[model samples]
Target: MSKRDYYEVLGVSRTASDEELKKAYRRCAMKHHPDRNAGDATSEAAFKECKEAYEVLSDASKRRMYDQHGHAAFEHGMGGGAGGGAGYADMGDIFGDMFGNIFGGGGRGPRRGADIGYVMELSLEEAVRGVEKQIEIPTLDECDSCDGSGSADGKLETCGTCNGRGQVRFQRGIFSMQQGCPHCGGRGQTIENPCGKCHGQGRVEDTKSLQVKIPAGVDNGDRIRLTGEGEAGPAGSPPGDLYVEVRVREHEIFQREGDDLHCEVPIRLTQAALGAAIRVPTLGGEVELKIPAETQAGKVFRLRDKGVQSVRSRRPGDLYCRVVMETPVNLTSEQRELLQQLEATFTGEDARRHSPRSSTFMDGVKGFWDRMTSS
Candidate 1:
């Protein structure tokens, strides 16, 4: 009988992507595998058909040829065979690509260690000016007893299960796949005398103190990386990196936003009206700020180059000072009489000149009430 279409055999669309094709092939191969359904010739044939279909569809050049000329592209030696693609006949690689992790496929090299993170909280002044801090971290380090060889005697023997190949082959119907040896854990060897210090892990858990220098202008959530400072790898493999995360603590005087700083400065009512020079605190130091005459409460003053210098651009930002006018609380009889006489000068029309904002607000309220009454 004529061969079935590759896409039809895999139950995938003609325009299926490589990932979709692999998934469809995996499903079909698993469902119709003869090992799963022994003594069933129909299922065995279906498995072969799906296997051939996958071999052709998974290859780029063969897939293109099949798309253009169909099965005739491979028939009568138009091509080598259905399994003619590069390493298509390698069942170990094919099945390992599909189910290697689940079945414990063996790997050649030593695995890298896991990374770690540490959070460092700094004050606003420290973050802006840069500071060096010492930190203690609990992590895995290479054991000194066995020199990371995992064997106390520094000797290892070949695995009996896989015979030093690290992988064991198993027959599934007519085909077979290779899996990692369970006896040696895919290391191809076994320790004769395990290390007493690390207990054959090659690394031990220990607390390490490290001095970290924090850069200036590093904001909260910024991370600094230290190479090879994380957990040590198994069997003397490479170590991972350590990440130091920055967190700025809340300040009593100033609030930071990016490179700029903001602070509220309280001034007396007389200072706001009459204008005066006062000392304002900045990241650098205290600076003289002149309050303009007739300045209102909540007015903002900008001091150039008085904020934080950015770590990235190294440019300083402006400091913003919000003024808050303070009202007098306590007064003596003579002081109260002097204030009453001063207030008496600004009455009726003079009140509009002295307190224009209050007069305009009162006028708006009166207009609103009159409109409401008329309506």
Candidate 2:
């Protein structure tokens, strides 16, 4: 039979990270566990399918091959060798080595719980100053009723199917396939009396509320890890961690580049021509910016230590204020006449001295036209 895509089997995106893949597998395994579904054959098949998918996707080399060549990469001597003969990992081995105890009766013992990821969005101000937030995540928590035993009577019996091996092997056309026991759900044990709250599974769905303290100067894409704050693992297994990823929202006034802050400061044409001491807004507060006489548009002024203090580096950065010259609008008749009189006076040497860039551009254009005409 043709196999489904590994990412599709695990119910995750193709770009899923290792942590995300683990979390997806954890959910799939718990949902289709034999203990929970008992006699359901469909869930058993799904459990095995997901297990096979995870085995390939979790391995870095195998996943790379699978991504590049699909299932052909692992086919018999397709790339170099049989994908399953030596390279393909069995379900028992997956639970035994990498997971280390996810299957209850395995020699490796139970696997640690899956890690969780959360993105926290903050405004520019909140990110710069730091903030405390209480977040609630829906996750699997240890059942309070059964104490993670999944049994009301607290009694368990060895599974008759695999005989506590947690896995069973079978022969397929010239090849052998090993998978977790369907009857016992790979736990190698059966619950005599299932817990009312969590069915046969040791964990229950619940919301976990936690207070997270964000350190100051945390930038976008920064992550804060909270130990043992993820989903609950099987009994006796250690829990995973929670990674809170920071996403800073766009600021209205300022744009941050590393530790430096940049902003546009608009000024009137008069201010640019005749110098003025103008107050510009900064993150800390407003500061006076001196615009020299005959200053051109797009002039940048750097203020030391006015940007941000990065969490990684103790040294503060500078804030650059780019000046934008604004032209006068909605001119009055008297003001227009006064400007015309000033324009009439700006001729010959005066125009060249005052409008040096404009004079140079005009001279360049005149020379280009002269060359074209001469040619």
Q: Best lDDT goes to which candidate?
A: 1
Cand. 2 TM to true fold: 0.71
lDDT of 2 by residue, 1-375 (tens): 898898999999999998889889989988997768988999989988897788678756457657977876445222211123443335434443543333222332345666888999999888888999999998888888988878888898886655665555433234344444445545677788888777756787789999999988889899999999988775425678999999999998899998899999899988998999999887788899899998999999999999988888867889999999888899999999988998999988988998989999999999999999999
C-alpha displacement of 60 in model 1, angstroms?
28
lDDT of 2 at 45: 94
Go through the candidates in order and give each one's C-alpha lDDT: 0.79, 0.77
After superposition, the stretches of candidate 2 with alpha carbons farther than 4 Å from their true spots are: 1-107, 156-192, 371-375
What would the per-residue lDDT of candidate 1 be over residues 204-307, giving only the tens digit for each residue? Answer: 77798999999999999999999999988766778889999999999999999899999999998889989999999887778899998999999999998898
Looking at model 1, residue 194 earns an lDDT score of 84
